[model samples]
Target: MWRQVALEAFPDAGIREPIGASALAEAELRLGRSLPTELKQLLLESNGVIGRTHVDTVWTVDQIVEQNLFFWSDESLARLYMSFDAFLFFGDNGGGDQFAFVQKPERADVFVWEHESDSRRWVANDLRDYLGRSLSAGGDDWYQ
Candidate 1:
């Protein structure tokens, strides 16, 4: 379902191979939280989609781990973690901007973390809604 939405958004995009069950399990262990059902389903279907607008790449499980580690280790970037420690980044805009799932019990909403401002804003209610808006956003005016 998410793949179809992505393809509709960027017909030229390609879906990556599905991540192994062991790898997914390892990621959950590392994250210390169960991946959202929609997220896991999307990954199992396609590790990530390439060549989409707004979110240019849906990061693979390994990429997720590496990116999180890189940002969490940095002094400046790590500052945001103090306030929003529950965030789990999963994609990038290819312009240093990141998208993540805010692991709150009430709702794991999607948020965009702007690299320039070091700020995060709620973007969508969930994975499916995020995919729809991302694909539908024309040009670079993603917020519009």
Candidate 2:
């Protein structure tokens, strides 16, 4: 179903092998927060989803853990921008902008973290909406 949904949005969407339950547990443990339910299910369906222009429309578990940890802990980033603690980053725009879920409020909405200005803005209502919008838009700056 996940693959079908992705393919419907972008015919050439790339689907990867799903990660194991243990990997999901570790990702949540390391991130110190449970992933949004839809995201967890999607990750189990495919570890990642690659969209237009080879962009990481949905990143693998490892990348998700690493990126979130870096964003949450980097001191330089702390000093340069607003806190990242409220967000859980999972994918990139092929440039620098990233996609994230609001972990603090625990909502299903997906937002884009504009790297340059450190701005967070709503782009899609939920994970499925995000996949549809990002994958079908066929452009790096789809949210823009």
Cα lDDT of model 2 by residue, 1-144, tens digit:
888889999999999999889999999999899988888898999999999999999999999999999999999999999998999888999999999999888889999999898889999999999999999995989999
> Whole-model lDDT, candidate 2?
0.92
Best by TM-score: 2
For candidate 1, lDDT tens digit of each residue in 8-72? Answer: 76676678888888888998888666777788888888897665543445788888877776665
Quantify all predictions' global Cα lDDT against the true fold: 0.74, 0.92
What RMSD, rounded to one decimal, does every model reach?
Answer: 2.5, 0.7
Candidate 2, residue 143: lDDT = 97
TM-score to true structure, per model: 0.82, 0.97
Candidate 2's TM-score: 0.97
Q: Which stretches of candidate 1 lie over 4 Å from their true place?
A: 53-55, 79-84
For candidate 1, which ten residues in a row score worst on lDDT? 135-144
TM-score of 1: 0.82
